[model samples]
Target chain A: MMPTSPVIPLFVAVPLAGAFAIALLGKKTRIIPNGMALIVTGGLIAFSIIAMRMFSLFGVHTYKLGAWPAPFGIVMVLDGLTAFMLFTVSLIAFLVILFSISYMERYSGRWQFYTLFLLMVAGMNGVIVTGDMFNLFVFLEVAAVASYALVAFGTEKHELEAAFKYAVMGSVGSLFVLLAIVWLYSYTSTLNMADMALALQAAGSTRVALVTGVLLLTGFALKAAIVPFHAWLPDAHPSAPAPISAMLSGVLIKALGVYAICRVFYSVLGVSPQLSMLLMVLGVVSMSVGVLLALRQWDLKRLLAYSSISQIGYIMLGIGIGTPLGFMAALFHLFNHSVFKSLLFLGSGAVEYATGTRDLREMGGLGKRMKLTSAAMLSGSMSVAGIPPFAGFWSKLLIIVAAVQAGYYWFAIIAVVASMLTLSYVMRIMRYGFLGELREKWAGVREVPFMMKLSLGLLALICILGGLLLLPGAREFFLTQAARTFSVGTQLASRILGGV
Target chain B: MSKERQPGMTLIVKTVTRLTVGLILLYGIYVVTHGHLTPGGGFAGGVVIALSLVHLMLAFGGDVAFKTLSKSGAAVLEAIGALLFVGIAIIGFGWAGFFFNFLPKGTPFDLFSAGIIPLCNIAISLKVGAGLFSVVIAIVFLRVAGSERE
Candidate 1:
């Protein structure tokens, strides 16, 4: 049985408080904002580590706000999935903030950046922990709003245009989500996820349920940038500053998009064969479409953005298989993807930081001038391309194996082909951007700042060692436990509602 | 008249704003404080308050209105308001649990009842008011800045 712990609320609280603090006093001194951000993100990392330990030691931890019961007042839940996401979000955020300390110097309004960044982190943490659907929507909006502003932080033409497009699509997606929440509330007579799950189980499936489910699925799919709904990602992801890109690509989609879909479908509504198949179809389409479009991009960040969509497809395909192994593989891939994608984005940022260009053709033989960045790029590329001994390979292998085990040989083949496509684009990036003769215009280029390199090195190390997560003890403790949350399916509702 | 004139709208409009802005702010505060008992709470009250400030800006021009609340000042207030709200919620941790209403529940409809609800409302009003005002300030001022950049 899971115990009720108060620490769950801190995940949302710390970052929020930090955001406010930075906004309030940050203008007093430039150092105040980024320093506070680093401290807050670092604290959050520590708290998430503690939460993960608590989840393993105690079965699950639920915190009831205002000391009210679960069905009455709002509650925050800390399960294996929540713990896992917390770790991912906070880890990436901390490193990114560290990266931003020097990288953000080029832009003004440094405090504003930290404030919005923290707000985004707070929102993601809130989304991960909140036990209410409406509450989830609120957090999603918080993150979305902050991100829209962050994307336009540059205030340049393309940045503004991209931000506007992203904002419109995101707002529409949120509207759908809100509508679904209303539908679910009306149908279930409850807003809490666990209670809603029980209510849905008691009421059984209805037309209303199906409609709401599809509405939610579509909304989250848009946020996740899955194929049919992914028109905005390429523009937005490339237009934003690199750190924000890393955040959006790394954990935002997973936390707000894939994670939400997983929780609502598997736990709240109960997964069905039809829903599973729907997920698989969306996954495959997203994968194929994302990689195909990615191959044609010369803009480095745009290419990475498309690749993000493709990786998301892999995650969706894994989860859609609906088996325990598939679930595990999907989550493993989720972690690996976040690490390498963030690394890749940060690498691009480094390249842009030094060369002032994001076009792959504009950069050549940067390997000679920016040795650390090139090495980081190589590591990220290898991992993302599913090269052996790197994190991405193991996850991709697991996903394909899981697909094959589920008797979906065709999906396995598609995944393999997509993997090859991923390799081609990644290699293409390396060949043109890093390996050729040095461009004469970049003759005087230099490596990025120490902090930026530090972040890149850290992420690259994670990418290289990411495969260690598959080891026996780590696999059972970390990956399996998180997968078990979904594997248990609708029983989670009963468990949550039952109390210890 | 050119040397002596204040930087604002027509004298008549500025005079009218001077007469009513205080009343608007008062009404907003009333709505915020009475939120625990009445329908209008922080968000509504805050918007009202912000509108009053916006009224000041609209009538007296950016220079006169900004003297009362500069862009950064408004931002500071917004941040404080948010922090105040969250801090109150955290104070609940000291009582029963996170966000638990620990204060004694006085008689309903009283001015100081509902534990933290009134406090929360005030915080919300401050945030919404300042935040909205700042939005206006940013848009109004940013346009000038953007035009200058060109």
Candidate 2:
């Protein structure tokens, strides 16, 4: 049996404590909530790294809640994929929290923001770690509810409207997920995902399973904002305060949406060829449609939001190929997108903080005045546009290679064209938002504070060097292990059960 | 006549609320404590408790409600309640394991049985009661503020 670690529950516990503490003590002093959020997210980053190390030592560690054995009670599984997701979520979260330190000064009710932010982090951590399907659903709601509240944090006309629309669609998606879980529970007679997988294997694929898969795909697609279900994202993402925008576009969608879909499809439901093909089609549509919509946008954050959909499409397309290489590429892109996109969002926040505008036409020659934000934006844009020597290029290259190897030449061509489209809009952002003549009104625009700059600089550096993760030494412990977890598929159940 | 004409409802509703709100709160506590053995638990009991507070607000209006509990106080209580729940779960680590049920298990029907379950119920009730009441107060105050802005 894999030795149970007591530290597993702390992943969810620490953040919950921080969030509540913020609510209670935040009223007393502003610094308390700020310090509390930083410490909690920073501590989580350390814990995720530790978890990654633990996975290296002991392949899969399962912590059964209430000291109960698996298949009987709720279990938190710490595997390669879980560690990867935990690290990604906590790392970006810490940076975003840091970026918010000065960025949130203009807003009222700072405590509420920190409280909700930590709650969302806790929920994502819970979703990643939990081994039970229903437990995942609960955490998913926790994250979703917090995001809805955060989206309306500004209390503006558009903010409220976007939040309401987002909430309605999110609730509908959650209902579909809940319905799928109910169907799965009825069919498999188990709540534990590993146990359910074994049960489904024993029973073989049924019509009920097929229905459950379709329902789950639709639900997660809505969460991930893939193509048709993406109406709310352009509105909701930009409506939030910028740090939240970063969280929403950066890790939230991937953690609550893409990560859940991956875990459920690969490990639990077992990806079928038809399912793979369907995912590819959706990915292509999301890619082409997202950028086409983005090309017409002048609002800075809104364009980035649309670009987020496009990037998520790339990740999804990588997964759709259904090879070990495909899994690796998807995961790499997932991590890379989280970094660069959050950086971009934070950069936009800095610009808005300085210039007080999100419209691209209103900004110019920011490259002269706001040197740090401009540089960060340049790095982020370069990374996202698949330029050489940046992280995005490597992942996009791998994805294309994977597609070509899989004999889907059309998919490879679509990915290439999408990359070119990505370059065009990103260049537009640089040209209009930064490169041109300094606007008269923005002459006095100053750089953001130290903390925001630190966040931006760190993320920009990562964006530039993110390709090093694919090197032989780091690849084994990080990406390779995560890829192997998915490649094994239904065998995950047997491994977990056998280990216990 | 002036007292009755205060911003709230008539004296009849206020009198009824004053008398019954305490009883409702007491019953909520009872349900929370006996949650391990009874059908009602933290969530239901907490809702009942919050409803009693809401009952007071609806009868006497927000001024009286704010005086008793206040927005900040309710926030503190909710936070404490949540922290308490998490703390209890953490304390389980010292006994059996993470989230292990370590409390003394007496007879099934006993009020004090299922050790930590009762504690957890109390914590949850604290959170739910305060949280629900605070949400109501915020919305009510929001309307008040909106009017003030106009």
Candidate 3:
């Protein structure tokens, strides 16, 4: 069989190539750019599926650079963890690309948006598959630089302000991460991730390693926007276009923040008691603080943004438990949150698009006028708020159960309370924005176009059925393998090297 | 634009700019090579390199400099750097017996003391230079694009 290594890299390469070609050609023909983006994302989804199958059959493959032996040059490793994240990212990108086709019409410079969008995709793919710490940092910056520009795409007064805030905070976070990476390299005397993990294991708890672990924690926490570091999110997310908002809340935070944090803490530094406690406290604090802040927001997307922080807390809490069950629960919730959270944001954005306002007080009775869009929003909100039978319920249940089992009853209780807060705000949006008396000004409004409806439907479907990923064979391929990979920790190098 | 100027004022401006940029380029190379041994690594050195480009842009003009280092071109360089890094890592994964492990410590204090890490450093230098320069150029041009009338 032809090797799957190149197939894996295509997740990034296709989008990047599409983006560049579109930028050059779309300048001459507007129709070409959107079509290329859509086609490229669709291809990515296909590639992600093939990757999933390949991982299931082959059990984690590592591709070396320039025919060099392992440990002598750069390497890209594809495993269960990489498969799971690649699927989430590309599936979301697929839908968002479709949504952008129509939604971006009101805005000029669509080609630039597509260009940056693809660059961001490439960066994310780089982060997921590359097996080195330094490479991770480079990819992080790649996605970050693109997102910064996209956030400022509109160039509105607020857009500039929000982008500046996001950029500054983001740069600060990257700087901290860079500093931590410097320490890791110096201590381990290596830059590759699996090698570094082994090095940390062999070295076994140095003062410098411990100190650097804290720096890594602080930097990743900022990216994750867990409680104390979440200030820029509400402002930045709401200022972007709706689909971009969904992408930001749904996948960007997970890819850049949660995924990277876990990889470094669990796989690299080996997650000390101090790091575990730090994660748990951040989880509980974010759960309570994010939801409480969310409950008072009148702007629809802002409320969703705040709730995203709360949901992220759940994922963190699960992983922070550092058990087999905790890993399962965390990965489970990570997938679910990406689905439901993005769905809810897109719903709010649809409301904004139709009614020409984001204020909950300004919107009313859109349910009658825009049934499909409204239904998608309603389902999305329900799923995100953890109503049973929806995907969110299962993940949140797993997390809370894992927390209690881990003897963190207080953390479990906070998780439950946060769910209630999520329910309240989501219900508030449905009532004030969707179910209230119809505004006379919006009397003529209709359902959004086909592209937007399609994207929303896809996400809504995922949110409701995401729990199915936990089934036996599927779980082994996606969640179990990934979680076990993390649980295995420090053994990663031995496994990859042994393969060689 | 004001035209009247003291004799050789333009020449002085050009010389100062060149001097400063040359110093920064020298420093960037120093920092990047000594990354594993010293304080700064690929990222800091790359930024320094990019700053020199910004200096050139400011000294000459956006239009003149951008034509040479356009946004599309810088973005392509960024991707190439990222690709090269991955390529190098893949080679290490296959040959070195472990991902990112280098040839047996090698003279511990030699030029290749850190194995493939220095190579990764150079790749990152290119990426950081391209990425940061792109950001600077984007910010500058976007500001102009926003203010200009049709």
Candidate 4:
């Protein structure tokens, strides 16, 4: 392909430059900062769409940096999986930035908020696109640090406390990932993903390799907020600015955690029965436990954060099944969830914006005040719950079918239970926060701004059409090629290295 | 929001504190860059920066020291450091004509010996120093904000 395809690096560059500019120039004019950030997000969405088209037309495209080969130089690989992720990341980023134009008016330092938000987008894009391991770690830290600051942006007691806690846990997670990178470097004597994969295959299975793989898995698991290492997420995700909360719940964990694990394990480590089983166990546990914890949360964001954990469980469960159909389902859910989850969080932001409260009990009949936000939340909740016709349903169905096909009946039951719990919480929000009798204190509240409404509407539209991803053409363009990329395994090493 | 500047000797202590912190920060870069060849890496270098900042903050007090250099400043630095590290790795893609292996060789037993290793160390130090500094500043600064954000 052409040397300077805008599809690959644009995702990272746009956000990085936007972030820097927002930080420096934003100090004076909030309007320009917000406008610049929105423009970046819009450009990213266009880039993601380009990547999607490229993947569909060309299969997998590798962007070799500085016109270099691979294994020796850094390469950015754009496959179906990456394009899917890019599409999701950019779409959510665009919407979140849109929502923030209005949502952040309540918070001071609009420039700071926009700057951090753009940095976060750049980091996530970097993670999704870069084909280098060290590159991945850097992006991971960038996104993590930005998130830490964004979480504490409110600077109130709870926001600070949560941001500090999130920063500590996240740093620990990053440390683990860094250590894993060190170990991988020591094992394969390489820092590139494809080269390492080839080396691991050549080296065969050794105790050191096994240990390193386990460490990488554990570190990424913490990042993905799997059951065992998920304590920090509930505290962290809820405390951020609403747009930030949406971004975290929507894409951050999936990109930094889920996407990394899938890429490393499937392509680098080469999935085995043992590793697959381990993933299954983790997925099942996270699914069950996360939902159970979320059931009682009266705090709106906290409950949604907990639900995010449970949803991640579903994504993992499907991907862990180790079938092509299962992989497809997992990637699909990842896309769908980003849509609905971001929508839900944005809806919560609107509610928070108008009512100045997050407690469900304090909210009542907000549907009257915020018709668009309520409608968006209701649609998002349904989509998340796997109601028929919504995007969540198709992915969930595929996962259940794939599990059943894999002969894991018990796991299917777990998936169903998780689905029910998801429905329950989403329903609770609609009933208590949106539809119930009007509360006395919040009666004077009004609808959120036009930008917020527009973003929510766009996301809601995506949630409704999420199921369309399963159609053959969409599947071919977005997900199948990614699954094929992972399945291609060590061949990716040769492809990047020019058949060295 | 305002602070009474320390009378005199304490101010000297503050001056000593700032210089000491700056020196430590300089030394930290050396250790972190030489990590692959010797010992220490990004994490260790970053911690040293935080330690130096803590000393300065204690001697100079939060207001006076924090004003010139804010936590938000450190946070942005951390992010930029991360971006720089990733950016270098991307640049390495040119040499091997690929994304992930060591080039033919650099200088063999020189300051520029390990092609990407030194660069990696430098990037890590930046990220770590800024990261650690941001964390410390956030924690300490929050204390003056009524300590309720928890």
TM per candidate comes to 0.98, 0.98, 0.83, 0.83
Instruction: List where candidate 4 sits over 4 angstroms from the true fold.
Output: A1-6, A66-69, B1-150
lDDT of 3 by residue, A312-373 (tens): 88888888898898889889888888888888888877777788899988888889898988
Error of 4 at B91 (Å): 12
Score candidate 1 by DockQ.
0.87
TM-score of chain B of 4: 0.74
- Order of candidate numbers by DockQ, starting with the best: 1, 2, 4, 3
- Candidates' chain B TM-scores in the order shown: 0.91, 0.91, 0.82, 0.74
Predictions' DockQ, in order: 0.87, 0.82, 0.09, 0.15
Candidate 1, position A349, lDDT: 95
lDDT of 4 by residue, A348-393 (tens): 8889888889999888898987888888998899999999898889
Give me the TM-scores for chain A across all models, comma-separated.
0.99, 0.99, 0.97, 0.97
The candidate that achieves the highest DockQ relative to the unseen native structure:
1
Worst 10 residues of 4 chain A by lDDT: A1-10
Error of 3 at A110 (Å): 0.6
- Tens-place lDDT per residue, model 1, A82-148, is 9999999999999999999999999999988999999999999999999988999999999999999
Pairs clashing within candidate 1? A2-A60
Candidate 1 stretches with Cα past 4 Å from truth are B1-7, B143-150
Residue ranges of candidate 3 with Cα displaced over 4 Å: A1-4, B1-150
C-alpha lDDT (0 to 100) for residue A389 of candidate 1? 95
- Give residue B2's error in model 1 in angstroms: 7.2
